[model samples]
Target: MQSSSKLFPVALISAELRGDLTEDVYLLKPNNSPDPSVELALTRLGRAGHDGARGVPVVLLHGSFANRRVWYTTGGQGLGAWLARAGFDVWLAEMRGHGLSPRNRLYRDNRVADYARYDLPAIAAFVGEQCAAPAHWLGHAQGGLVLAAALGGGYLAAAQLASLTLCGSQISRLHGVLELPPLIWAARLLLRRREQVVAGWVGPGEGYEEEPAGMVRENLRWFGRFGEGRQDWAAGLVEVTIPVLALAGAADRSAPPAACRQLLERFGSPLREYLCLGRAEGFAEDYGRAAMLLGGNAHNEVWPLLEYWLRHQRLPERR
Candidate 1:
């Protein structure tokens, strides 16, 4: 149940069979975090038949107000299961106080800064240690922003990563209404009154939890439409030279294609590539924020493209 290495402690909760795939969940405590009670939950999905051998490692991070279910479902579906079936070592990470991860002492006070500064690197290091190789990372929406913050702050080293993918993530989108203090207060009040949807595909009911107010405040600050300006992302982001892929949803009003493109353009990686998911780009339909990963056509159309990109570290071959 519980195990420890010299570095930190890793507790294996359970290993169950999800049809043809194996699911293993662990609670990882990183010693570097300011809060010792901060433990992250990671679910590993692997296929049968490969003795113990693992293919390339891939870590999937969900957006804010979401959890691991964003990339995986209990029925062994979603991108995480698909990657596992394809022989890649796939990890679904649940942020602190979300899903399988329990709340820390200062859970409500947590911010993206806390996640980027401590949590992400810890997860990456643990993955690398297990697979003995740098792992690829994919972030959706706010998850992508966390990745960018980690890289920009020099918290996650390039050597620790194989590649980076930001799906429908951008900081350039300005929400002018959030600038008003009264509106910000009202937003928090509303979030408390309603169920926060963690599973975007599940629609307005169930799979919900209340998000921390501190995180909401930090998110607003990042927009720079109010409060002080955001951190100087360029200094650290331009230093990131890892292979990068930035994907945008054509119909995603939350993060438009132009904003996504702007984020990708700031990266220093010479191998940077941009993709727009829409009919014009040969995709089945114009993807929205959540549809980019959960739409009906995603498995048949988008997943294959992701697999190819991860394997080749290049753009997928067009049909």
Candidate 2:
């Protein structure tokens, strides 16, 4: 299966030596992409002493305006590193113009429609070739939406996926003004003069990278119709049948638990699970958006539940 990977065209850009693990970065340029200069980065983290024997392949995707740092810090302290240390073949993906991936010609014009239709399928195919097995996909925010779009559009086949996990992501929650097409159209029209939108200037976070206004436009469209281009992804979601795990933070007003549950309900999977992180859910605190994953107590509280689910495909027992 590994030998067949050569059939796909991928360029290995660099290999960085981490303490105990090796990080191999590959740039995948799918032939079908509208932009020939587009190259999506896929970073693989694994150790050598395991004799190349890998556990299940798991792909980690970052949210909007974020990068690979969401999964692993420079010090190798996040979930990507933890999963690598645990023997899972982990791959962290950087969407166009994010993290290690350089901006493509269409960077300003790229949207989730391009990501879900073009980038993700290429990533999955590359991972599938290397691992010779289906991957378990885990994403946060816009990353989750990309996964949903890929699954719903049939860009990613069920045979290429082991499971799906969504964190702090939902389309059910509507942003009143943001949901209006005319307003979004006006925003995009205004953004034509701007190259990128800084998360700190507009949203609640700091240190986030600048993102294409196209992403904001696409998200608004999803919030309004859950469809992109000509495809009705909202209607297509019911066709996804893989086991799914959806998580929400109790204090995450951005993506409330109720909204996340609505997204979970749309999946056709028989094995669907939902969990809300808060004192009511037996957690120490009511986790907010980033707090749910990167909080000080997450290592002891949240990470274990994620590991358990990735390993067992079931909810962990209440403490």
Candidate 3:
């Protein structure tokens, strides 16, 4: 089916060998989307030894106000690098307007609905084609929201995924009245008066690409609502029987542990599991949204668990 579309997922632009890692970057454009011209960037990482193995692929999706680099930086101090070294075929997806992906024509008006319905499926299809098997997906923070929406909408078919993991992501958690409908609307009001929300300009994070105003408004509405405007999320989740993992941070007020649990409980998958990173859980320290992925001690503490999870998900080969 992917082969028939004019804007199908496979459009390889560059394949370069960088040391022990082989990096292949592709520009994916899904013709099924409202904007077929919207192009997303996907980066695949593998080693020469595993090139013949064709391990079931694992794709990493970053959260809002961030890009693909969040999964790995130049020094290779991120989960994407860690996963590759652990012998998993890794792919990093940069959503529209993030990282190396160029902003779409409707950049200011882009929303998560578009991402869930369009970008997620394309990433899955492309990775599945490259690996010749269903892929496991891990989404962090806002990326988790997008993944849930896609799963709910059935945009990510069950046959396309071996497992699903969500880290530091929930739709119903609200920090305060700051996310109330009134404040949300007000934020959109203020943002519409400008071009986009530049997080670093507004605060003290690294100056990355500004987020679309439409995305902010759409996400703000989800602060207190689960299944944000998704027509198929409830139905799609009811049919998902695959292994599912939802990871939360004990100290994360941004996406509280309880909220993450609520998301898992509401799902119909029987194999659903939850992990909270906290001292009580026998972790070194409580992990926040960022710390769960980028903390100094993640490699030593949580990454091994991630490695184990993916490795265990591999189906036993029949003789």
lDDT of model 3 at position 246: 90
Q: Model 3 over residues 83-186: C-alpha lDDT tens digits?
A: 88777889999999888788888888888888988888777776765677788899998898888888887778877888889898887766556556787677
lDDT of 1: 0.82
Stretches of candidate 2 off by over 4 Å are: 1-5, 174-186
Q: Score candidate 2 by lDDT.
A: 0.84
TM-score of each: 0.89, 0.94, 0.89
Cα lDDT over the full model 3: 0.78
Alpha-carbon RMSD to native, per candidate? 3.4, 2.5, 4.3
Model 1, residue 197: C-alpha shift (Å): 9.7
Residue range with the least summed lDDT across 10 consecutive positions in model 2: 1-10
Q: How close is candidate 3 to the true structure, as a TM-score?
A: 0.89
Off-target runs (Cα >4 Å) in candidate 1 are 1-4, 175-208, 225-231
Question: lDDT of model 3 at residue 205?
Answer: 43
